[model samples]
Target: MGDSIIGGPRIYSCYKCRNHVALHDDIVSKAFQHVCSGKKEDRQMMTGLHMVADVHCADCREVLGWKYEKAYEESQKYKEGKFVLEKYKIVKENW
Candidate 1:
């Protein structure tokens, strides 16, 4: 957890520790969580209504944030299959 990749793609790490927390990339890829996801439910976000699943860290089991499972509004469709990490809990790793 302490070792940093010499020339790795820049990622986000937990501010509280050197734990691999999240990835900050332009590509909107579906997060493959072999670990786990909380129950899927619809919630009204600032942007719009969305069905999201709470994502958990496999290593430390912390509440990383959520995955956008489904977007109800057409304008918010792009957010589907993306993640939302807590801004206050993460820091750029290699940037």
Candidate 2:
């Protein structure tokens, strides 16, 4: 998968800005999207049917995560309108 690699062997930064950063190493963390934009569609996920919009990095235009447009399942209702940004694993080293 795509990972930030602006030197430091594993230091990750925005593919475009290269200032703000995040790390990727098989760890997936959840995030919410407040801005940026993507199209919405119904997609079958592990949880169930979800109407989601792909959240892309404003700087890179890369699909980062997703925005839950609507959740059909009652239990999953809490996820509605929530965001899950690009999954990443943070690493520590020379900075």
Candidate 3:
């Protein structure tokens, strides 16, 4: 079977902070840098004890989504090395 839906490229930005997060068809996740876990900072958690960090806008600091520091399941090990963008926190812009 082939993909039933065909769509154009999407640009995702933070809804609260209006910061450009990613281009859906392009780079989806960026590298984690200087992330801290606390009330005012990016929240960090563990999925089955695998570290995951919630990312936020650099300027306005709105919660965007999370980046997996380690993979919880062996089958999903690829996610361990990348970021996961939240759909609810982003707006899609299409050209």
Candidate No. with top lDDT: 1
lDDT by residue for model 2 (5-87), tens = 45543444444445334444422434322236588999999999999998766666666667789999999998886666553
Q: How far in Å is the alpha carbon of 80 misplaced in model 2?
A: 0.7
Per-model TM-score, in order, reads: 0.70, 0.59, 0.62
Worst 10 residues of 3 by lDDT: 34-43
Backbone clash pairs for candidate 2 read: none
Cα lDDT tens digits, model 1, 18-61, are 57654555325564433357899999999989999987666666
- 29, model 1: CA deviation in Å? 4.2
**Model 2 weakest lDDT span, ten residues long:** 26-35
Better of 1 and 3 by TM-score: 1
Candidate 1 local lDDT, residue 51: 99
Q: Residue by residue across 1-94, what tens digits does model 3's lDDT show?
A: 1122255445567787666666655453453343322232223345344566667777677767766666556865766657766778778666
For model 2 the local lDDT of residue 20 reads 35
lDDT of 2: 0.61
- The residue ranges of model 1 lying beyond 4 angstroms of the native Cα positions read 1-8, 23-35
lDDT, residue 92, model 2: 38
Reference-based TM-score, model 3: 0.62
Task: Please give the CA lDDT of all the candidate structures.
Answer: 0.71, 0.61, 0.59
Candidate 3: global Cα-lDDT? Answer: 0.59
- Which model is ahead, 1 or 3, in terms of lDDT? 1
